[model samples]
Target chain A: MKHMTLLAGALALSTALTGGALAQTELSLWYHGAGNAVEREILVGIIDDFNSSQSDWKVVLEEFPQAAYNDSVVAAAVAGNLPDIIDVDGPVMPNWAWAGYMQPLQLSEGALDGFLPGAIGKYNDEVYSVGLWDAAIAMYARKSVLEKHDIRIPTLDQPWTKEEFDEILVKLKDSGEFDYALDLGMADQSEWYPYAFGPFLWSFGGDMVDRSSYTTAEGALNGDAALEFGDWWQSLFTRDLVPGTSQDMADRETGFIDGKYALQWNGNWFGIKTLEAVGDDLLFLPAPDFGNGPKIGAASWQFGVSATSDHPDGASAFIGFAIQDKYLAAFSDGIGLIPATAEAAAMTKSYAPGGPLEVFFGLSEAQAMLRPVTPGYVVEALEFRKALSDIANGADVADALDAATDAINADIARNNNYAPAN
Target chain B: MAAVAPTNQRLKTSLRYLLLVLVGAVFIFPIIFMVVSSLKPDGQLLRDTASIRAFLPVGDISLDNYFAAFKRAPVGLFVFNSLLVTGITVIGSLFLCSMAAFAFAFLEFKGKEIVLSLIIATLIIPFETIAVPMLMVVNSLPSIGPDGLTWGWLNSYQVQIVPFLADALTIFLFVQYFRDLPKELIEAARLDGARWFQVYSLVIVPISGPVFATAAILKFLAMYNQYLWPLMVTQSEQFRPVMVGLQYFFQLNTAWGEVMAYLSLITLPVLAFYLFLQRAFIASIASTGIKG
Candidate 1:
């Protein structure tokens, strides 16, 4: 069956190629990094460089802004017109891989051993995708703002308990310099929820779903620890620690920049963008774990090759070059991410300027957890996050969680409940 | 003349001028603010109100924002694509829709009422409902060639242009105008032994200037502002249109100043077109004061 499917895919791809009027060997690559013109220019330069550097294949770079990238991807897939290469958020990788929309990588000798272990995953012992880079959510504070309150910087490695976090909020409130002590964002969970709340749920040792055999314990939505985490989060809004308005996401970061909020939870990506927007008065700290669980922000993105690709070897080779020690260092230098490869990460740490790169690179091993890499994670995580929002808005934490749990389990069951064979 | 006193006329003119100035200020203030905001630095964006001095840039006012914006993506390519698509849409819609309207209005075709009813029926169904199937048709076009395996047709102007060739609303607009047109004129043309095509091309088209102008204006604006279909069909930035390009600009919310500048630039052409067509467009719309 696998052989027949492979042959069919090959036939379809060939027909798509020669079916065109042109005789050129065109490879379609879809990307979602066109949000900024600067970023778009960078992407275009990469495609142009690749085209100029190779003779046998011409890479056509297609981009949609991140907001519409996924819809476009799925639509393209439904039409049997999936791109030859795709760069997607890591959470969606498993679903696409499981649905047979993406092809697994068959590494050349020593290629499998080169990347960090946790960065790769296998289903049925076949590696599906590789992490291009690592991203994590952490707490950010303004140095001057903290100094105004005479508060010493909290050690990130140490997980602050619930009581301690509340105390810091009280201190900031009493200090009278800011309107809010901490910005516990609930407004736009689309971007901030995965990074901010995912870690919070994990800090209490809660999993969003139970896939124990797959190493994802499914009860994160229904469990007591998750409920406690929700209650504590709700208190932030209920007690007026964070605004309840829809503008909370952008408002929180801007407030922190304008000295309105003392502490904010955002990922390392925000760190670099913030630095560019408002210079380096920002300091990073690990999300408070409270000792019950480890602080783990959600992973950001990974690069993968298409299963239907004609030049898988070349694609893998290009990924290697894109994340090589010097290239990784240069690419992630201002981007606020730890390099996925150990050698690249260490080199970045040793040479990263002004010490902020060290702050990000240091968190790789300190206290972090990955978002569940399961086939139903995207559907499960979104519904699960929406349940969190309802809880934060004073809905019954347990009931809201139960519904999310049911929704996730239903999705998992619908995806054929694949039990990975050892 | 006896009933209209000079005093009353003077008062009326004053009231008209007053209303005009008030409405003008209402419309112009936001544009003024946008221009000012584009000139301001990043920090002043959320400041609610910026000083007039903020607009001058004082060694800080640079074309850097616009330059950075243009450099960020293929703005030039998008502009060309947009011009090509929208320009063709304007011409196609004006000619084809007007012809169809002339048929519905004057020609005694079979099932004329039924045909008109069916055409109007399409307008009732929302475009969103049919967008999915329409998109499938678009994607499958390249595969419809003789060999049944090609993709060249999917991304070209044909895919973009064909689905939107005959809009129901445009046909409706032309039909309404043609119904109001003098039937005597058509009879006179026929009496001169002119064929139906000659009558429409020469007589009807010449006399129906205002209606055609209105249809052209409306079609140009709709196609110019279209974003979603092009975004789906176009594979690469090399063929992306201007609306998609502007959407990408706004997506980078981190760079507000540049977004504002790019927005200002994108709106300029639309504004210029509106200005050029204002007189003709107004006459065309106003001519519809008495319905058929």
Candidate 2:
């Protein structure tokens, strides 16, 4: 009975895909954008165009807003009511992959090469998801503020040494033009902490766990470099620059726009909003690569095909089309973010008659660090962020790191015991 | 309660009024913020300070957000789905629960006490614990009539309404109310050669207006506020309830003005219903004893 029911479901899915009326394949795509008017208008037009361009398949667009996209998608998957395509973040790919929610794409035919080398690995051995946008982390500083204070930021191609970065912060502090020399959103441990601060630990040559044993009882929190970085991060609070609201949850964008923050640590996705708010006053630079370790940045959004989708072929083709040069260019112009494919970089330049976007894109390509693409990475990332936040608020560094390590270790044991390929 | 001097009582009453006003303002602050913020442009949603100067927007308030929200999704279809699913769930739950309550209260049956215990026991088990299993059960059922003879129960009004049919809490409430009824009246009706079903339909049901009203109001609110289950069952906006629709609207659109407008729009129906039913609830309460 179950088999027969599943067979009927399969038949129904195929019919839905094939546009049962036209007998053309119909595929439903789910995305969690539409935060602003620009994204909503652009995405709708793109889907409509995709639907009209084909005779064999018509694409249906469904949106889950960023706020509740994760919960909604998980619920949809549990109910076996998944759309043909979904836009999942890089950190979430492993969770979906391990849970058997994503379908592996047949990308052996040179299709995988179109993406950055390490990008596909985030989705496990099989190419389970395709990169949508380059959400590389970078710094945005107010050029006018920096210039008025006679402070020059290090170039996009150059790495800022620990001494140089500190010197600049000290200089800004002394200048008194801004309330804080930098606003990295340190107080909001749930979000800004892990992504903004995790790279610092890595740059200091510290690992969250000793990969050899992968056990919390035998973790890497005792390492000297990790403890040193933890203390340095805590200093931001000690210095009284980290703003604390009733909940210590304040918006970084608001701080920057109001001229309270001289420098903002965020991803490339905010480029358009920053531009719209402050215009040429914004200067883009790579996330400061503190020497002696790898530059760690975030890999942002990706598109995945649902395991239940009947139009995998057309969906895959649409994934390719969705990131095409023209659409990417137009989207980049409208949203001030990098295009998915490298080819769209040229178009991005053409769309914006400015230097910052291209400079930021180049820096993004060079220093981007793919966040750990493990199942349940959100839990781990969040715990790690909490450790840093605790340290920032004067908690013992060793204890905080130990607590985070214990949490991530437990998460790994429960969710992903699979030995990693890399 | 304490007895007070006349002057002290006057002071207490004034203080009570002041306290009520303060509490009311505190409760309504967020809603007011949402409404006012929605009127402002995107940039002003999170302004640093609120002053009388900034209470109203500088630019003209526009209905563009509402227009954009409707154009973005099928709002009409959503309203129809909400009406259909909520109406069916409310009505179906009322009838099934009342009948089951009547049987348990008045009829003789084997292991009646144990069965009643089990039915009530179901209420104690938190729905969260069984949500996964319950969803699997719902998904497993075909929405169409038996064996492809009709549309599978899924994505259908019945599928959306059926699982909600047997609510234990509702049954327990109805059973308690019906058990208190004067059995001689039901006995008299049955002795007149009326069928068992006829007694329930013609005599008992007609006299159970207050209890019926109580059950209907509770079910209506539950069905109206429902979000997750309806979202799971309905594949299209054409089958979504109001809460799910409004939530999706808020998610897709961040411009506060549009969100507030849509919120204010959807909230009216429930608000109106509540105002209409307030009289019924009050009257029912006035007549029923404290225990009932």
Candidate 3:
């Protein structure tokens, strides 16, 4: 009986030790890169590192497809089932934070210092999310096509002026060497509308919403500058200088590569593929200057802490650990985007100095601009998309802009101008 | 003139066949394109879209995209999850809904008409309208599982299965079909020593193949094509279905070839299922005039 009790005590002690070794608190993370094997592999590496590198927390990943990610997160938030760590789109981060789906990140004070401004998700003076890389848009063109046409290759400092870019498109169209002068990716009707085209509006001194007040888009969207931007935008389609809204998606993917389109206004995510196709002749030019300095849409997917997380520190710790320069470079190498910092850029194969995709890093540094940082920006972006789609289909530019302005203003008023919490 | 009439009849038949072939082509072309595209490189697949070549199995053809798709996502797991969820839901729905229909049709109950009407009224209310509320209710429901009595139902097969077992549309389909069943069959069964349960199992279910097939197909399609609810509820990849898995192919630079390959793979089960039940489903629709 005594021997049996001793054996039981030893068994209990062994079980306790095993339990203690497995006591790392599990922190759930939801990511929006479910199908991207390269991204998945690199991210799994980061998660595994963070899990093993610490004693207090172990992060578990749940990945959703990017298309369904936002709605899923919103629904999970409604059910109060949001995971501890969530990755959000950079522009949409404000809306999520406003909806109380996310909390301000709790990384160390200087952790974000060397990161690109676009890589940092800031709203109301607090950073709520941080991305490992920033995406930039550029004019994808063939150097040979431009040189053959005798059009001067523009630099970051001396981007083509609005008038020069317009004339170049006309010249290319008149040459009849291509089916179209430009492919604006009109087939993609989602956020691509606002992300790629909004920068043109900004260069024309117009915006989706008034940044100073975030209350109404009256002057910002329908003002004289906006009306001018809209006219130019519609003229591209009406004149057949660019593909219309009904452009086939397949055409958008292959037109430029097949030499059916002379140029494509696309993001850096396609930089590597285009480079492989066009080889040494490919160029990533800056967005044209239209009175204001040249600009390209900035920011990409980013990681943040969910507001309901009972373990914010652990969630933030994982995020902080994941953003180390090596990991950032790994992500950049795996997927072609601008690394978040110069240090990380130096570590990447493509974004490194004198590399093939080095120009994108420079373009991102010199010209990248974040979309309006407000909760109302989501509604504002939707209205902007509709307005642009209408204009492309030959609606009166002034009428489209005015309609967008009213809808945006109404939305802002409906939500009490999306007042921020102190 | 008799010869002319015969010739004209032949001409009319030829024209009808031509129109039928055209309509069939219109429906079948997308599937053909998907299968053909899945076997080609992304570049060739995209290039072929402009011509009749897209429908042909010519040029740079291989199963590279399908292989890449598998490497990219756990395609088999997604298919299994979808099939399992769909299979269980269809079986459960057929049984429970048919039983309810049996009771409504054979047994006299109080407020029967009003109750059936209420259940049918739910058909008009979109699932999206009540998705969030339903999500909350499911999250709070108690369940005994491997963990031994869990409070929430998130990230589990039962979560995907249980809430969908007896949706209103499936019940309505069963009720409509059961009502149309000859009352004499029920009367004869009751005149025997058989109980109501025995009649349902031994008699009504056996002769009700057409309705059962129709309901099974409708339920299977509905459950298999579920996107929003699964997206909202299944946070873990292990519980995600094929539709949600389809999203994995749409990165910033979407892999069109991979998307087509995934679609082709997921579509096989649906095609096989429909083909299996199509004869009975058609017969049911012809008799009942109920369009699914």
Candidate 4:
């Protein structure tokens, strides 16, 4: 009889465990890293940990390719079937938030204190999303090339002045040792335009739009500083210091590594590969100051809760759990991006102090500038890209800048200034 | 003089053969490139792009890319999904569109000309203009599935197949072909106490092989290459077609060899379908002056 009673007790415990497992709520997460094997493995690991860590929520992931992710999310939003959690690009978060596709994230207080500013997505004074890593751009050059050319290597505190950088380009071109002096990656005609070149305009004391108002581009994109930046940009093509808009993409990928280009302005994602190729001769220098302090465009992809989610708390919990330092380090090591926090960076193989690509961490901290943080940035980025392309193709700087400014102003007016002042 | 004439004829024949071979090479080079590149590594494929080597099957060739491509995405699933959707839609489109064409061509109906004109007019309206409205309609549609009733057809094979089963182009192809058929065939069948459906089945369809082949090939290509509509409607990866699956290869740094492998795999169905019906399709084009 005692043995029979013990058997009944065991059955009762098993039934209770099954009941608890069945009661766990499922949360769907949509990611934009569909074909990346490393990202998939790390994310699946996180999901497994999160699912087992709590009985209240079970997160399920759906991944889309980065190229098609935005369209998929927008389509889902239109169908009123968006997932509980969505991964959004940092610059694009404001637009999605304004469109009611996303809601402000709920996390523990002071959870983001040590995070990089660019890694945090804030709009209308609310945190809509947070990223695990940030990306930084640098002037990629071979130390041997710089030493042979008698060009002084620039540091974070003492970057090259505008005239010094221009002179170096001329010197490199005059040597005839390379096909081009600099590779600005002109072949990438997409977001690379604004993401890489916008900093040049900012360093020249111009901006895509007046950040204070988020309402107009007047006197910002078409100002004297912008025209100066544009003229310099055009000279890069007309003077043959850089390739034009019609540059071949194959050349862009292989030219710098093959010694056909003296220096390449590229992101840290390519740093490891270039380091592997060039060994001890590679250098990642700071961007030229251009009169203003040196700058590089910032922000990367981040996670947020969907506005239509039935369980925002559960989605936020998963996002908060994902931002742990270990996961951030894993992502950095996997994707070669700068970790969002110093602690995370220290744990990463590439971003840690004394690491080969460690300088990118300092660059991100010191020189990274967020793209115009407003819903109108979407239109602003496109116009800026078009204006930059036009200038590279020899359009009058002032005329092209004026057209971009007018276009931005018109969009702002059409949208009732995106967010009107009270 | 006769000997000289024979020599001239030989010269002209040689010249004609040369021109035909040149044209054929121009058409076949891209397919050759895709298949060849699919067997090479990414670095070798890219390096070969600037030279004639791009079109040749030489140097560091292997099937590693095809294996990697399969591992990266559900290549088999995507191809299967595309084939199933395209097969069903093509068969249904042939039956429904040909029947509609028969009514307009033979059966007397009220306001048929206006209706036919309106239907044909849709051919001019771009699909992109109507995609959003069509998406809205489909999102609100009801379907009977394993679950007793589902409210929306957002992520289903039926959604991809149904809206495309009776396109204006297919209907117009059938209508033009049916109208060109001898009226005496249909009249004789009707006089023999055959009904309208019987005349359509017995007298018209059996002799419409070339048109059927023509319409079937055109519709197959259109359905196989569908990207935008399926992208908007099918949210589940299980239901996505090959065209949308192509985006899976385009990451931050695209793997060109894998992309070529996926392309080569997807093109098999299209090439096979066309080759199977090329004789009839070519005959149809010759008689109707319609080019695919």
Candidate 5:
């Protein structure tokens, strides 16, 4: 009788343990930082913490290369095998949401209260994604070069006007001290074309598409302001103030630091490296005020729940946990992006006050503009890129802008304006 | 006159050799550049591209890129995955395609020509055209595994291998090679009371080395270099092949030296495979006039 009671107790204990293990649901996450060691490590740490923090869910991660991530997601969506969690580019979240690949994120009421505006992704008035960090662009110049040329160094509050900026470029070019006055990274023909140059259009009092309707690019793209922007843009290439579209990628990578160019418009991701190379001379200045205001492209990768996920609440819980200030600071320090929140920035090595890239956080906060927040923005961006490239290569600015407007309108029409009802 | 003729002949031979060497260099330059650049740092590698120094090992050279490449990704695992997939598929395809080819080449059956024609007709349909439909089919298909019967073959080795086992190009190559063989061998084997299977095993397959080599190499290359299909199917890195692994090196700031290093590592298997079968591949090409 004693042995029988012991056997029953042991069996009961084993069953209880097994039942507890089986009770935890598994959630799969797809991330686009497969080869980035720092990103992978930080993300893996977050997943481990999330899994251990709750008994209701266990998250599993699968990473894809950044270059191939979008295509892989689309393919998985078609196969109906999307994971429970997916990290999406902030600008691209609307397209994926519209295509029914991603659903709106679920977070606590004050979870994103202090997050940068660019780090919060919304489509159709519903929050779809949230990021740990954001990226900003600035004019990279050498303090020594600017001082030698008697060029006024632009600040967040007091930026160079259009005439002043143009005169600086001309002066720098005429000095014959550098191969080119500026490196716009024209050789990077990918998303950089639209992301880097679209801000110039905005600063010129034009936009990629009219934000009022988010449906057309008619006056917004080819109007008088845009035409002026386009002409000034083309003159940069025609006058040889900047390298043309045929610029070598190697030259673009090394130009400003190698002293081949006086100024380079680049992202904060390159800030630390340039700082290291040029030491105290490297300056990350605000974008010159063209006319209306200084502007820069915003948004980076963010986490969202997939539409196909059976456990969205669990996925949202993971995302909410990941957005903690510590994780945000870790990501910023690891990848050189501006932390999403000021609190996170204060904790980061670079984005903290008086840090090497401290100004970038302010730049992102003040000057960053999200790309057109609509599914049609994808096609619009491509058209804008082509028009800009054509104009830079000496095409008629008016004709190129007109063609881009027509193409964007055609895409909008083809997709039935990507209306929310559909 | 005789002295002049000999001298002219020597001059012609010398010019021919010179042209051949130049053409060879043109073909080999990119490979040399990849290997040499793999040994240099990214800065020197980019700087050297404008000169012939790109193809020369004359810089601050180290195997740092190779080490970094390994650290960034599972280089060995990717190579192993690709090799395993390619090897199994090539072997399976050779067997199945050759057996099918034997039926079309030797056997008399109803609608045999029609069947062969239909199989050949599929060659015109590009894989991209059918990829979506094929994905759907594979997703719905059933498989029995250690976990018992399961629907959807997604994220499995069989998904990569099974759909590619009976390709049209391999079948056509085997059929063409089989048709050219004399009918006397089959007749003699039959006269000696050998079954059709016996004839296939003893007579046809034993002598069909060139076609086997040709098909194996062609299929090996195809399976090894697959990018889109595997990318679409295998979501897990455990099953990702080298081509998909190549994307891992293309980060925001692409490490060019590491890219070259990764490429150099993945390319070793292909080079070794070709070298091992070069004699048979050449003989097959010379006889059959087929280009792989």
Candidate 6:
């Protein structure tokens, strides 16, 4: 009789444990790192930890490739099938939020403190997303090449002025040591145009759209500063200081490393590989100052709660849990990106102080600026890409800029300036 | 003089053969490059692209990229899903569109011409224009499965198959072929006291092998290359097809070797399907003057 009583007690305990597990609500997360094995492993680890650490919420993960992720999310929104949580590109968060596909995040106050400015996705005075890592672009050069050419190494505070940079490119091209003085990765005709070249425009006091109004791209895109930037961008091709739009993609990948190009403008993701190839001679220098100041594109992917989610709190809890310094460090270590927080950077081997990729952290801290923060930036970016491409192919600078401005303005008018659905 | 004429004919034949070989090589060069590049590393592949070496597996050749590609995505699952979805849709499309074409070609009814014209008119409407509204329609559709009635078919095989079961192109192909099928054959069958369905099954279908092959191959290619619909409808990785899976290799620093490897892998099924139906498909186009 005593033994039977003990077995009954054990059964009751087991049932209570299973009941507790059943009580946890399932939160589906849509991630955009499907094919990246490291990201998948780290993300799955985080999900596992989060699921085990709490009893109120259990997170499930579904990953989509980055190329198709945004479209999938939009389609899901149309079908009313969006998951509870989503990871969106930081620049695209505003558009998604304005479209009612995503909602402003509700995290604990001060949770985002000390995070990089470019890592937080803010729209209309609300936080829509937060990223664990940010990426920064640098003018990749070999120290030996710069020293051999008797060129002064530029710093963040005193980057090369517009005339000095242009003169250097001409001198390098005239030396006949390189096929082109610089490889701007013109072969990459996608977001690289706006992400990499947009900074050059901004450095000239021009922008894709007027950030102040968020309604029109008028004076910002077609202004005198932009036309000057366009002219300079075109001159690079005409003067043969840089490869044209028809540049071979393979040359862009190997030109600098193979000694066929004097400089390359690339991001930190390629830093580790180049560093391994060039050793200590590799330099990740600041973008040349084109009168306004040195600048580069910023922001990477970030997490947000879907607008259709029935449990925003649960999704927010998972996002908040994901932003832990350890996970941020793991992601930075797995993929070479600037960790969002200094604390997280210290934990990462690549982004830590005195590390090989440490300069990128400083670069991100000093010069990383967000792209235009309005929903209309989606149109403005593509337009900027087209204008830049045409200018590279020798299109009239003013005409290209004017055409881009007109298209952006017309799109804004069509969407009622992308007014909030709310 | 007769011997000289025969020699001249031989010379012309040799020239024609040489020209044909050159054209064939031009068409086959990219495939050779893709397969060759897939065997090499990224650095070697990029470097080799500048020279004829790209088409030659001359250096450090291995199946490492194939292995790495499998690690990046469920390549087997994607190919299986694509095959399954494509197989069902092709077979169903051929059946349903052929039946509809038979009725339009033979059976007379009120507004029959208008209906057939309307069906053909849909050929000009791009799938992209209707993709969203059709997505919403499918999202609200009721589905039956082991779980009993479910509301949405968003992440299922049926979602990919059913909507594409009767596209305008396939219907048009069948209608054109059916219209030209010696009308006497259908008349004789009808005079023999055959029902409309019987005429379709015994008389039309048996003689429609070439068109069936033509329609099957064209529809197979279209369904196999499905990217946008599957991407939008199926969020789950398990239901993703090979084209969507191709995006797996397109990271920021794309693994070109793996991309080539994946492309080569996926092309096998297409080539096999085409080769399997090559004879009949050629015969169909020869008779119909319709280049699918």
TM-score of each: 0.82, 0.82, 0.96, 0.97, 0.94, 0.98
> How much TM-score does chain B earn in each model?
0.87, 0.79, 0.96, 0.99, 0.97, 0.97
- The DockQ score of candidate 6 comes to 0.84
Most accurate candidate by TM-score: 6
Model 6 ranges off by over 4 Å: A1-3
Collision pairs in model 6:
none
**Which scores higher on lDDT, 1 or 3?**
3
Per-residue CA lDDT of model 5 for A173-256, tens digit only, reads 999999999999999998898899999999999988888997899999999999999999999999999998889988888888
What does candidate 2's lDDT look like per residue over A203-280, in tens digits?
776755554444442345547878777777777667755454223223554778778777877666666667778988
lDDT of 4: 0.93
| Clash pairs detected, candidate 3 | none
lDDT of 6 by residue, A253-343 (tens): 8888898999999999999988887899999999999988899889999999999999999999999999999999999999888899999
Q: For each candidate, what is the lDDT?
A: 0.69, 0.69, 0.92, 0.93, 0.93, 0.93
Model 2 complex DockQ against the native: 0.20
Write model 1 residue lDDT over B57-143, tens digit each, in one string. Answer: 343456666777786667778777877888887888888988898999999979998998899889899876776677787776655
Please compute DockQ, using alpha carbons, for every candidate against the native two-chain complex. 0.24, 0.20, 0.82, 0.66, 0.67, 0.84
In candidate 5, which residue pairs clash?
none
Instruction: Write model 6 residue lDDT over B91-164, tens digit each, in one string.
Output: 99999999988888888899998988898899899999999999999999998889999898899999999999
Better of 1 and 5 by lDDT: 5
Candidate achieving higher DockQ, 3 or 4:
3
lDDT, model 3: 0.92
* TM-score attained by model 1: 0.82
What TM-score does model 5 achieve against the real structure?
A: 0.94
Clashing pairs counted in every model: 8, 17, 0, 0, 0, 0
lDDT of 1 by residue, A1-422 (tens): 99999999999898987665254467777878775644455556666666666555667777776766776676666556777778767677777777666777655556646554445645556766665567765678878776876666766556566677778788887777777887666556675565557767777767686546543334666787877877877777777776664544336547777777778776676776666655777777766656475576545566677766777766665554444455555445534466666667666643254455466555655666667777777876787678877876788878888888777777767656644322
